[model samples]
Target: MAEHTPEDKAARAAILERGCSTPIKTATGVWVRCGSRIKSRCESCAELYRGDWAAIARSGVFDGPVDQYRFYLLTLTAPSFGRVHRVPREGGQQGRCGCGVTHTTKDAALRGMPLNRATYDYAGQVAWNRDAGVLWDRTRRRLRDRWESVEYFIVREWQDRGVLHVHAIVRIARGEAPAAIELRDAARTAVAVSKVDGSVVEWGAQAQCDAFRANGDGAKTIWYISKALNYVLKDVATDADDVPVAVWRHQVALGDAARRMRCGVDCVPQDCSSLVHQRYGSRSQVVSASRRTKYRSGWSFTGLTRTVQRRLRREWWESQQAEAGADTSAVSPAPLEDLAARSRRELVARGWAAP
Candidate 1:
């Protein structure tokens, strides 16, 4: 680690006082991130947050030796405004859009671009994004009322047509697991009405609620949700410099619309400026409040809080180190390349290296 200059130290101190982060410059000519959780702003912190979220979900599911929980992987999607470019299932398969081009994995332009940008519902898209949290809250409360004790981790994702959707991992007590169909029905009912402006917000006909019985280690479900989070984080692009030309144009349009749209009288005069600032400029993007806090109205938790989770994680790491004591014969040095790669990953995750 490079020694910080007086000015750097002062800036860091000020950031700490404000409960924020200050970027640091490294010797490798890369700017160390401030660990922002918004993927469009900081990929490194987004990855770290995803890993931590996965671990938290896993711990909630597998807290006991024997599998004793019931899990539901729920997907809630918004209604489509228009068709968009979709990659074919296989190499030789036909494309789904009018573009008639089978986009490959490397074709970033087709990922989130609309078939007709001018006809896309930019206002509805931004409104949905702003109201997504509210919808999730309603659905969560409905689930909790039925299951009694439930914990969930939800992620919001952007679709190929530039709309927002949700993916959630919901856990309930073992014997209290409701039928998948019933859960789906409840979720649908909860989302049929919008809490934002009393308008009907449909979750589309493609909503899914998959139930998984926790047997053995219960790692598969955890890994699946974690992978979904990874995808969501990786797909976010806010600036023209960070994405392909087509995708950049779409994002710029969305940003502009988000800055201008206003829904109703109670709504913020600006395009949810408070929500945008809270999401992009503060630690609220990653750090959630505990159930005991005033900000816990939305997603209340009955399992481990962040502080307890961190303590348990530290204890587990220490125990692993103790178990590996003085085992030079059993341990082998990692490859040089692997070590370098891991160092880079850690530095990036900890905001000491650029993404």
Candidate 2:
């Protein structure tokens, strides 16, 4: 770190407050020369930064295939505008009525009637998209209440592919559950656990709607979760360089070329690159493209082995069963039934049809 000159301090305040197009000094006194875009930096600094980002993205964790015991897809979304939409009138007769009313059957009315008021706020939507990532992070932490024991949950990252969303795989410890009913209970409990202040919006221009889904099928679930997380990594950088404001540093060494490359026993020093080239001609071009692309693959977690992946799977399995038993034993069976009913109602209100 370096000390900032007085001019740097003034520029920093202006850049931060007024979005000035100049270099700004951070509080720690490091000068952040704001480029037109992240790519437009001082030549030396830009190359170093891009190379760093490229390295990380080329070898990031969330990109590769992972072994999971269970898989699930969770949907987290922002609420809609409160504007009214035309709906079919229910229980109407004479085919028409005064007040410009068009009559229809009960079923038609139910089908056509707007479920709720609609609203429109472009600014709110933009703001919500900006804050969606933060909100998801907070919401995930709030989910701890669903478990008697603290379960290990690691967020892969929010993804934006064909759709923009967040994905995470939670590893539950094993204990009691071995059936779908118990697993369903855990999933419901996980969904029910929510943050009170997760409004994500402070005013009329606020966005709402948050949800989650849990898969407890052991390794398959983890694989799916990893895949979901991979969706995000496929198109972005995963190092401090891409996120210059970051307060931490993450780096990896290549180690022995053979070991790092996972080369075969037959590979020799002089023929390694040539051997690899022979084995992957056009494929090398694809790898090169990935190297230049914004997406990253070198993060620590991405380097996990099947052994580690399986261990996590087993841990989550045990945790889930243990949680199920504890929950079942802690309360009366009648209360559980009541809980189930209420949960069903909430689900229905949220758009799921009743059984």
Candidate 3:
């Protein structure tokens, strides 16, 4: 390994403080110009943040802009894997031993250990992830065949490396009275969910049911769909050789960014925010009893109380809509009248009978 001399140490410190491309010292005590801010970044830090961004983006199935929630059943899914080693916790191997104490079982002994093992069919996992978008389409076709009310279910998968997960937002038309629960159940049943070796994929019915119960609203059926999709589309391997060049480049950039910044991908923005905060040296200050600090300048450019993402998204959407000559003002509006009207119909249909 190359030893970090004084110049190298100085360069690392400068990069850490000012970022990569800024001119700094090199190992030979020469000031070699580092990459520019545009081209230079902490690669590892970037990857981690990109991964986090991807996860959050995929979670869009769980929440969305107003007016569109009524028409979609968002979902996730995962591939099956064979059994492997076990930890004492996490419902690992529980068989008794001749020695009296419950001992951890071998890989072969735990062949049927109920879908917790990471030893998946690598090829199947890769293939599944690579074609998860297609698999989702097939599942949608199966769903339409089973349910008459279901005009179509739009299926999309978020590929986070080999871990092929899905994010399906099933779109239903207006004035449909399909039993959402039954529709979801039938879709699950019809879909050919299984391991590469042909073991039936374990549908997490309990979790899915729990999400719906917790929400306690018929309109919130999307929660169950979100849970189901998230459950099924668990981690699966991806073939490195099969990755596209562009994707590989993006992944590498993100990975490098992540490493240099010493932060996870989702936290990149946070990391950047933290650095900005440190630069400003500002602390939380409460102005009155009714209001506390919603956001600080250090954390973000325009810090506020709710939906930090809303502002960023709103701006982006505005820009896009403007370019496309679409109306941006009506994109997202929060009004009691609108909420009441939407809720009235849902409440009446659910037989709330509230005073």
Structural similarity to truth (TM-score) of each candidate: 0.65, 0.27, 0.31
Question: lDDT of model 3 at residue 250?
Answer: 35
Top of the candidates by TM-score: 1
Residue 179 CA displacement from its true place in model 1, Å: 2.6
Of candidates 3 and 2, the better by TM-score: 3
Error of 1 at 157 (Å): 2.5
Model 2 agreement with the true structure over 1-355: per-residue lDDT tens digits: 2334655555354334433243433333333333221333233323333343333332332343323222224334344433322323333334443224544433232221222313223233333433444444444444434432222222223211111333333332234212333333333322221122234431122212222223324465445444443432232233223332111111011112212231333544454542222211111111111112134222222443323433454466447758876321211111123343454444445554321
Q: What is the lDDT of residue 108 in candidate 2?
A: 30
Candidate 3: which stretches are off by over 4 Å? 1-79, 86-120, 144-181, 190-355
Q: Deviation in angstroms for 131 in model 2?
A: 3.0
Question: What overall lDDT goes with each candidate model?
Answer: 0.56, 0.31, 0.35
Clashing pairs for model 1 are none
**Cα lDDT tens digits for candidate 3, 1-355:** 1335754555445335433333333223333222211112333323322333333433333333323223444344454433322324345647654234354533223222223313334333433433343445465566556543343223233334323333334433234434556555654553444322333333223212112221246346544444433322222122234444434443343333323331122434333433212211111110100111333111111222224443454467558768999643322211123333443344445544211
- By lDDT rank, best first, the candidates go 1, 3, 2
- The residue ranges of model 2 lying beyond 4 angstroms of the native Cα positions read 1-73, 81-120, 148-164, 176-223, 233-355
Candidate 1 lDDT tens digits, 1-355: 4545665554344334433343433334233335445566555555555666665555555564325557777787877766677754335555545687767655544665788989988767676666666666777788878987566666666565556667776766677888888888888767645555666665667788888765743577656656556644644443233456777677677767765655444656453434342221111132232143443322333455544544565466446657977322211111123333454555555644233
